[model samples]
Target: MLRHFLTLLVLPGLVVNSSSSRSSSEEEKEHDDGSREKESNGHHSNGHGVPWGYKDQTAWTFNFTDCSGKSQSPIDINTRRAIYDPTLPPISLEGYDLTDDSALTLWNNGHTLELILPNTMRIVTGFDHEFLAAQLHFHWGTPEVPGSEHTIDNVHFPAEIHVVHYNSKYANISEAASQSDGLVVLGGFIQIGLHENENYEKILAVITDVSIEESNTEIPGFNVRHLLPNKLDRFYRYNGSLTTPPCYQTVNWTIFNDTITVSRKQLKALENTLKAGQEEHLNKNFRAPQLLYGRHVLASFMASSTIKNPGLGRMGERNQSTEQSEGLSRGDILAIAFGVLFGVSLLCFLLYTYQQHRKYTSITKDPRQNVIYKPAMKAEA
Candidate 1:
């Protein structure tokens, strides 16, 4: 009958809705993967068939121990909850102004686009010792999904660039990567806008040459400073690990508050680029942010205002790092100066009143003049 047919259709819809809710509820479980036992016991080739990608991070071989580590990278930076510490100084780049073309090379690591720099280029300050620049890479998503590894206030940016470095105190990157505070990574957010960042274009121009995995090419070396934001003082600092495999918890992360603008054309080039051993475009090359787990995110500069959740495409309004990053603002300085001046004036007034009262008491208590003035005159005669 017609009624029976309609009931069948309604039952299918009800079942689909129930399944969808179950799926969403499963995802809401804080991203905790309970299938570790099954994943570990399953025999996959040592490195050949290791299923490593953005879709399933448990398949990564190096992350067996750190998959559930307390300290992880690409965390959500809630600026409102960050502590403003003036002691965090502005990062100083030592040899980033590379005029020598021989110093730079571009390569397509299976995961992201990478640019290798010489050890001469290093982060001179912002740590107990210097951190030598090893390499820099980017993570991005498609036009629809923002792929930045780290998010601000749970809002994802179009992309993110990580400048990886090794601590100078260590012999090499291998040794530094295992120790605490051994690595320093400078993170900068990228946003899609109308204008192109000519500085970033230097590396993007060679996207075709390194289109495949393990492919690399030479590029005319430019100033590495161009890759970073103009302001480096205002940043969120925290202790975290690398996002990829071997998630070592040794990095000192400094993610800038400001963002660099890139054109849609450039973003397309990044998104459409091919990965190694894949015909499809390498899109959504980012990891979801992990829980904070009570980690403290320190800020170099005091935030003037709170950024609303999902504040994207508003680079101009973001905090800038400058000379005033660690010091009090002009208004704060004036307020403190006024308070000190008022306190000093009040103390001076109290001292003057006490002196006047003492003088009056001394004059009023001159009883010798009243009783002894005449006796003293007779004695003198």
Candidate 2:
């Protein structure tokens, strides 16, 4: 009974962590309409834009009151402290297998490169309601510092990706942003691996074009699913807010226990490619860990067990003509290796037993056989 009740707590967009809900004016405050494209010529420093940056994240509270809220985001996840809720289901994504996400706009939103995703790519499950894809952006660090927003066991990955979504119950993301039970953000940690991730080529290839703030380019879509950690079943769910300014407290955060990989070269490109509005290099854009303030982090899978994420990025490049297939997980590869070894050992044992049986049979049946053979040899001589 407790597990079932805790399952509700683990659900996306449902949180008991907020001390007090945002008031009517705060709730109706305007923001980006999830997937809508921002104007390229627009720049901050205007009354419309907030000048707050990573250099002074604390100052955001002055302008955006929600930033100081109890349930603010990008918190360090102590997996040991997280509640192990067996009832939490695997995050279900729909329409992510795009034949062509290439036509979609990839924007350099000044702070980070934002990929405006289509509503067709909605998360079908693992939430209280269907949530439409808004935009996915990345946060990263320089070689000196790790930049993932939400850390696992206080260890930061090279980068992280946030896929923002809004509940389908609302007309659009702008409408949903006002509700406490409106937004859901899927977070995936990014690691550097031996091979370059071809899945990211769609956005990485066009980075040069959008190096400047507010600039955007049309990107060809590969499978959008590849951008996420391969194992969606294991994740850390919590009630949090947008990691950036105006840090809306409406988001239900689900940080994947798994991590996706990119080549060192790709990570560097992601870290160094974009420029801030001042034309400075934009790196280490992640926010520091916020005070949990009594909010409980819930795990979809057992927290005690180590998750073997080994994302699909390791699968490496494939020809466009080749069919995309799921690669073997680390567990799958280990199982296959064990099966092969066991089969070889079994075959060797069977062969040895058969040889022994033949030798024993010949020895035991020798008297009658030797009598006939001796007669044949005498005739030849």
Candidate 3:
């Protein structure tokens, strides 16, 4: 009897061990698949990363038809002159206010200032750009580094705020989102430092009241203009797509080279906001850097001139004098003029022949005789 009982126990143990081993293997496989998806160069079997049909838990989806050829993505900034009429209307954030219930205000409170944007703002003259603020969001790292998205060049900041916007005069956000001219996102990089933002403090004061499960807060009489950088003159512009899922390829991203200052307190507030209901302490919020997507980045000096270069890599300190001229070159202009002249000459020749035909038709009226008549008096000479 004792031997039989021992055998039974051993058998159960063996079965349990085998099952556990299989479960672990399956888990590892799933993890590997996820890693591969993330590391992929914006390509997926279901077109998850590319600008095609894909959807996620968030209400966002990717469909290229919705994007514009000149649609702004996260990195790309297209330069066309924007005509602004000061007399037409001034954008007012007067009725806007922030509270624990306001999602945007909550984000700003957490030192992710770049995320909460105004619906309308100022327009820059030569850049042909206007400010439209979208929702606020964050990206972070594991406990070791603590914050920010890791860039392709292996550079990382403390945290980044993406203030998304669209050119409303053209179309609504959804319609505009798919075009190259569709969206414009202003990116502000935050670094952990000693200086504290007073505006951020008011926001952080109410973080404890906001819920974790995507809730909205009401902030009465909020003025969004105060949150922007005072020196709007300097910024790095590029053409890139959305960094998040549905990774829509329509965005004109303007990343300010100037890093905003956030206090350690503000950073902690953001960490707390992210930690609302997680048991395992899910701290990471950033998506890994994406492929540069064969785009060029341009920089314009508010105080000086515009600098344009290939968007393959980072910017360099080439003097304004060293920059190459853009648009139609001298040779191109000459070619265009010559083409126009040729077209005009052809048009004039056709007109002269039409007039001569009309004159001949008026004089030569042959009802029965299908013969041409020459002037008889000329033969005598």
Candidate 4:
């Protein structure tokens, strides 16, 4: 029963901990104290210990359940349908440069770039949108598992990086989140493996210095361009809310299907930074799942296009090719059939066992009943 529940509720790549070091009582005390501090300071706690009035009124809530009813809920990217957005601004690396000063600025301010959009980057062939680079931050777990708010197909990866970007065309992050084209977040999922990531190493090298609790430090000269994957052609795009509260519903989420590789050593470095008090304790800084409102998740390149009447002719041609490729892949269908069969067999077995037990109980209660055999004598006569 526990296994069944876990299968349904937990993401695949997440490591489940049976015991958390901090006592329930102590945790409650800390929570209460934190709440009081927020009220006293006239700043609301987003539950991630991020005080109000910090960084444009953004608060961080550590747990997911507390984020209910907000515009953003951590969505399972794998489950969402991918659609082609011809309107999707083209992302290019031309003319954009990363400098040590930018890196240092990021490190010093404790502000990470979410998305780096330069004026030169085009969304489509002819149309362009000017976007500014913002900092990227992570929500993660301790040594055992990855810390990510959103899941993919109800599965969690080792880590999820949110590359937040604001349309300089918009006023601010919050304001941008309010408009359809205000914010664009590129989500990169990471897996724990033997492969080494040089770019990740560069970022990890400086994470230790700015990791002080609740203290925001900026790393100077950090350029956001270094983190992008070489290939951005295939991705799952959707209209969803932010994964954190005041869960703004105005985010254009583009989740890449491919996962980036990060070394165990690099993962450990991040875990070390998020550790709770007392070296022995693990930092379980994950939010719970939120309600899936009556929202339809549209997919593109899977079957049909979700975006209505996309204005580009090339996009339509591309969609047809993608759909054909997906149709040929029978693996996903086969897996689903097998899973259904297994579930049905398990259910039938349980039902049969239950009927047998009931019959045995009935017989046991009437054990004294016995019948004499007289049929043979009558036949012989």
Candidate 5:
């Protein structure tokens, strides 16, 4: 009985030690996280420390220093102020449809959800040079706050997706990132609504798998075109930098005017699903709009056109022969109809006047007609 009592006492001590060790380990982990966050907020002796792109950093003032470059990005796209450049060609996205499972890896990079794509994808034309596909990522905010990086006329959207590419003229994406005119990013706005955006299902369904920071999963390749707006012709273009830092000023941005829809539930999944540390979810991952300075924002569509009558500018340059067959506007057709009717009426009136003059001449001047209708005929009648 004494031995049994001693075993029980020892067992309680062992349990206490085990609990204490676990608690200490957890605290140590938390401390490590806190230290990392603190260190990242302040500048390190070396150039690299925490990712300079993180929004959570509070100490280092230098994180925003790169943001003040001459050509920073996420500017407000004032459509009215934008220049209508007919030279801005329709952007051609090559190999956007990925079917091989081995080509795709979806990851939660702690800051945002990123997808690794194969280099087979590319931008054939649009800019002065060709840009090869690198990868894609997202920026989003909570349900209440819209989080798109680039705003339209200062209006924000629920989310945004950036399809990043590198100037193929350079060796690779990393090499191109620091050079001017070395990157081209296709930005698409994401709006929340009632119906499920079928195109978003590929990304949304995988959110649960990578709910934690640094978590990743290999996904079967999907049609990447679905992620973009249906109308790629109309877009806002400008010279800018990566919204993230080392805020490279190499990016030539093209933000689509058309917005893709995401269901409210999917947006909730995005806002609440991914987490940075054990503390909380990734709420706001977007940087606010940067200043334009003296930069020009060019548009692919004509400025005179409205959203209802949006012009598909000069498709002939991209696709040969076949034009955008949407046909003329009602106003254009009406003008043509009025022009035709005026021309026909004028012609008919001229012809009737000519005929009357001809008949009068024949009656008055023709020898036989004159003999019949002259004073002799009147006297006979």
Candidate 6:
């Protein structure tokens, strides 16, 4: 009985080291009501290229056919439900490192800041067909709200970076955008890190140059590969359409499982720097997560059965303790290890104490059972 009591006490300590599981928020309560369907290219309601904003998305279905497609992009990736594809190869990039010999064009297309890349850079390896890197852009929100387009297990991150590419066989991006496997976009979530990133700074440094809509500027070239997560092997892949309209359903999406991090200061700059209209700050430019409609979300690596939402607090804000959540640093794992060791040591001490108490109780009641008496017979006298 004493051992049982000690065991119960020790169990709680072991549980203390366990990581916290993500709670399902109201976002999870949202279900696919089968309203997301197909559109005929969305020219009637809004008119092609007229203009749309994130504030209104229900109107997208009325204008574009593919916008209401069953396999739309930016779907909530339920990590536990993702299917593992062992055959999926590690994403390989070619000619991503750019020297500042020639400045790259940076465009403020009214929605987001875009950095145009040379076609020489490409996703040469990974899929059945090669893809040429076209341009990369970001989707961001204000400090109060996280503006990432794609979400993980219904949990939103501070921002998301998308590197867009087009199928190489096509003459241009337009020709490829119509095919089933025409475009491949690499997406990585952004979270706060311990320090500012020099790689990301290259872009943010010149953000003010083109603050207005329909503006363009040239920024010094830098290694574009550093913007993405280092672990290219782990990713979530699926066939989905573009988040923006005319929502083309021809993209092969590869969302990195491991997120990249920038400092809190850099994050704030991203939200406040760019402008969409004359004075309106360009934030929350991302569309809401669309329904999956039974589309399979594939994984390049085997995903954990459990889904944990660390780093993010309520309303998808970063918690101070885990602000630098770039896939658990060495310090975090070590802390967990030390916590488990301490719990085990305490359990051992409790077990030993319980045994000593039992011995004392038995001896106190029946002293003869444990105590050997020396006979006091003075036979020698």
Best-fitting candidate, measured by TM-score? 2
- Find the 10 residues in a row with the least total lDDT in model 4: 22-31
Candidate 2 wrong stretches, greater than 4 Å: 1-49, 305-381
lDDT of 1 by residue, 166-234 (tens): 678865444454456556788899998899888889888889999987577878778889888889988
Backbone clash tally for model 1? Answer: 1
Query: Please, what is the TM-score per model?
Result: 0.67, 0.69, 0.50, 0.56, 0.66, 0.68
Give me the displacement of residue 97 in model 6, in angstroms: 0.6
Evaluate model 1: give its lDDT: 0.64
Candidates 1 and 6 compared: the better one by TM-score is: 6
Which runs of model 3 end up more than 4 angstroms from their true locations? 1-118, 122-131, 150-153, 220-223, 276-282, 301-381
Q: 2 or 4, which is superior by lDDT?
A: 2
Q: Where is model 4 more than 4 Å wrong at Cα?
A: 1-67, 78-90, 93-96, 101-103, 106-128, 216-223, 275-283, 289-291, 294-381
Name the regions of candidate 5 deviating beyond 4 angstroms.
1-47, 51-61, 305-381
True lDDT of residue 227, candidate 6:
96
Report the candidate with higher TM-score, 2 versus 4.
Answer: 2
lDDT of 3 by residue, 1-381 (tens): 234222211221121112111100000000022221111112221222232212231333323221222322333232321111122122222223443343343322111222333453433332344534434455554435655542312567777655555555543343344444545555667767797876656555665555343233434324444444545445655555555433445455656556666788787766655432333233455544443433444454421223333332332233343333433445567899999999999999999999999988877875645767987776665
lDDT of each: 0.64, 0.67, 0.41, 0.45, 0.63, 0.67
What is candidate 4's lDDT per residue for 1-381, written digit by digit as tens? Answer: 233222212221111111122100000001133432111001124333434322232234433223344335456553323344445444544323445444232221111211222233323221245554333555556565656656766777767776555566654333343355665666677778788787777667766664543333344433455555556655665555555433435556666666777888888776666323233322334454454453333333333323333543432333554445433235666888999999999999999999999999899888465655565555565
* CA error at residue 28 for candidate 2, angstroms: 13
* Least well predicted 10-residue stretch by lDDT in candidate 2: 38-47
Candidate 6 per-residue lDDT, tens place, 1-381, comes to 233222222222111121132111000000012121111111111224335666788877886565687877779988665655666777889989988875787767666777767767899788878887767888888888999989998999999998887678865454455565566788899999999998999988878888877577878778999999988888887777667765656567889989999999999988997777789888897888988776666666654442233322212322344334424535567899999999999999999999999988887899477778898888785
Better of 1 and 6 by lDDT: 6
Q: Kindly indicate the candidate among 2 and 3 with the higher TM-score.
A: 2
Alpha-carbon deviation at 82 in model 4, angstroms: 4.5
